[model samples]
Target: MNEHDLRHLEIPLPFAPQRHSMSDRAQERVQIWAMRFGLLADDAAARRFESLGYARFSAYWCPTASFADMLLVAEWITLFFVFDDLQNQAITTGRLEDYDRLRHTALQVVYERGVTGPVPPVIAALSNLCTRTFPRNSVAWQRRFELNLELWLIGHARENSFRQAGRSPGPAEYPRLRRDASTVLPTVDLAEVIEHTELPDALYFGPSYQEIIATTADIMCLTNDLHSLAVEYDAEDTINMVTTLRDHRGMNLSEAVAEVRRLIDVRIADSQAAAQSITAEMDALHLPPRIRNGVRRCIRDCQSAMAGMELWDRTETVRFTPDEELGATRAIDYNNGFLDASELGRAAPADSRRV
Candidate 1:
């Protein structure tokens, strides 16, 4: 509730920190890419976007990726930030129709590829991303990524419905919704792509692996809610867990913050245990050395992602800071006529040989 409570709150994460060697190059590439798609209005807007440290964030999550893969990962993170801001604006302004339309456009871009006709800058950028990245991975990975993306979009709609009704989700219902809405699952899927490895369907959907992913999502959502608490509270956004706990669970501000922090700790512990369980299960299965190593690497990637996100939030990103302090100029309006539709089109079909 108070700045002091948030400032003093510490969420412990056990993973060691790491950063990509190509982070600076990746950052520069993403800025240019964003400008090409009209996501950044001008030099000033580009600078503001850079100040957000998205490239560093991506680098932390994917420290071992090649330069090309790192750039793709950074681009995805940048797109997520832009999409989140635009969606938040739509929901806050009660523009549910626009929000729904944006969701549909995004889904279409991923599902159909090379979407023709004019679209918003974000959608256009997404189409470009999919065209460039999808062919590098397997059909199975693509399908998994698409499903997670759909869940994330649907989760936004669910949150918007609560906002339109002027109500917060009950505490019991929030965790499930937050997991999908956080978009962490897709990022996890991206890890597999970046590593050029895939888990068999059975291992991926197993209880232990699923638990690890769910706990990671919970940790991410709760950590974000805590860091952005002051900003969201100032904006009167009631969708965050802290707000939900305070309003729906009848807890005071201090109590709510403490409770959310407590929940994060619990989830972190659960995530570690799940990781251990999955490793043991893999050993028990006596899988081939290659498959075992791939699975283990994937698990490490998820832990790295969690740690990377926390480190970026704490040290690099200016997102939780006030706009005035950062001299931020561009607003989150994707329909402001800045997008050029000339280059927008459907991507070529997926190469069946990529898998």
Candidate 2:
């Protein structure tokens, strides 16, 4: 197979003797697949990723996790994986003009939203990965890496669009979204990955789901921040993700509500646009029905979520404070630091390059 085909590939379980227990054996399978394909980061990094929750929800291979509460998480990830696969293909001698359009559209979103609109870590890491895999100046390598980064940013916004759309109001043009993949790979033993990174368990949830509900939760957690960007943006340094905006004005009660409404409007437009794009693609090319259906569901669900999300208000947050600002501020500051690290190149000042 070509390199593009291998972009999101998973390895088969590694071989070991001594009759490991079922769970350990299962975990070994996860390792085998991850290591063979390079998914297994250093143990400490993995730990950080898991500790931070990246592993819990985004380990795409283990299907047992559910996303019911946050079904969009699963959709966004599934979408990310697909986009990654497609980008790999594009970079590896497969080009689709529409993809360029998509990438630009996403960049537009980020530009409009400003610095807080994007995250960069995955792109940077993937670029580093590409440098290791292909010769410098390889168009395939450059495009492939570029596309992955773009998709991650777009996925960041898209997932929120799904959440803001909320649960279906019952059989609109697009039905509510759901996934049964978690049933495919139920147990994701991440101990090995945890040891390698500082990523934290939230990453695990991004890819962990035993059923659809859990998968959705994972997906939602990843994207819900966009819908609740207000919460994350305006929250005290103790618990906010949009740190640049943490001290910025306009995050107060009334303004936050207004932003939600405005975001929902944009999401609705996005939903319509994505659907149109997919439908146009369908006119000439044939794709797996499952993917088409999945796209349809994600589009509809996210649109609905966006609508309901407009109702999100500052009231949802607890405003009580201690006599003075406490160390709790670091909770969000730390997460933001991680996010900045994740952005491709210098989402913040300290985001220096590392192998």
Candidate 3:
């Protein structure tokens, strides 16, 4: 996509509510599940969860879900963050071998249940999620989700290898790795489970439909990289879109941030176009009314994901703030919203949270 010369850019917001009404229920579920998974094993762990705002983060994914489904989805999101926090610690501590072992153990728990041994909290959480969420799902859906999770881990390992060798990925290579590493696909996959409707294989695997999901992932990844750029930079992490662009394209930080914003807008436009095209194809296709409705619902869920997540990124979480102190609360300047050119900076200030 060509970078447009523009004075200001507005990131799209979800027309629907950013969160479900059962905020209290969602919060309680996260707490109970965190305890069950041993994520709140100590004061330090409890403090970290409090700082991350897991409940706030969970509310953003599906705004209209039933309380039961919302609880499942929130716990699922918790599983991701807990796993992510553990991996970040592993990487920060230079425990690459331990990280590898953790990956192996988690995957085994996901794919080969009933393995006898003590399971860690992360894996325990994952195992519980798999049983609760996937029992009635299609084998194909299960496999797709499994592959997405596996690829995410693989991407992290690949990025770690580059760090170990003191190398930076070129602009092209970075997106390829980031797509999987970002774990957007599996996140989007939840639209099916929470909505309780599956897109049939023919529609799901169609070119236009796949494009819609990929563009959704692309949009999410760009927004995330931009949001987290400052934090990653502060940590001296090189495996990020901003850093990759600066190193590979020889641009300064401002140039990279601008380019990434342009890319996010471009992906948003592309996903809209793809959604329209897929809808037309669905209308033209002669299918059972139920199946047709399922496809339509699936499409709507994809759109909801974009809006929900955009709202969450801008308003809910402290994961991308400039301050290292995670416990402090921050206010969101929606007027100075995400993708606004005027708000562009190395990172959101300690006072302002941005997507």
Q: Please give, for residues 130-171, the per-residue lDDT of candidate 2 as tens digits.
A: 333223223432343344344444543343333333321111
| Segments in model 1 whose C-alpha atoms lie over 4 Å from true places | 4-9, 284-286, 323-355
Q: Give the TM-score of candidate 2.
A: 0.30
Q: For residues 93-166, what per-residue lDDT tens digits would candidate 3 score against the true structure?
A: 67777667667666665565323333555555666676666664788888878888888788878888887666
Model 2 root-mean-square deviation:
18.5
**Stronger candidate by lDDT (2 vs 3):** 3
Query: Clash totals for all models, in order?
Result: 3, 96, 0
- lDDT against the true structure, per candidate, is 0.76, 0.30, 0.65
Identify the leading candidate in terms of lDDT. 1
Better of 1 and 2 by lDDT: 1
lDDT of 2 at 342: 27
lDDT of 3 at 254: 72
Q: Where's the lowest-lDDT run of ten residues in candidate 2?
A: 11-20
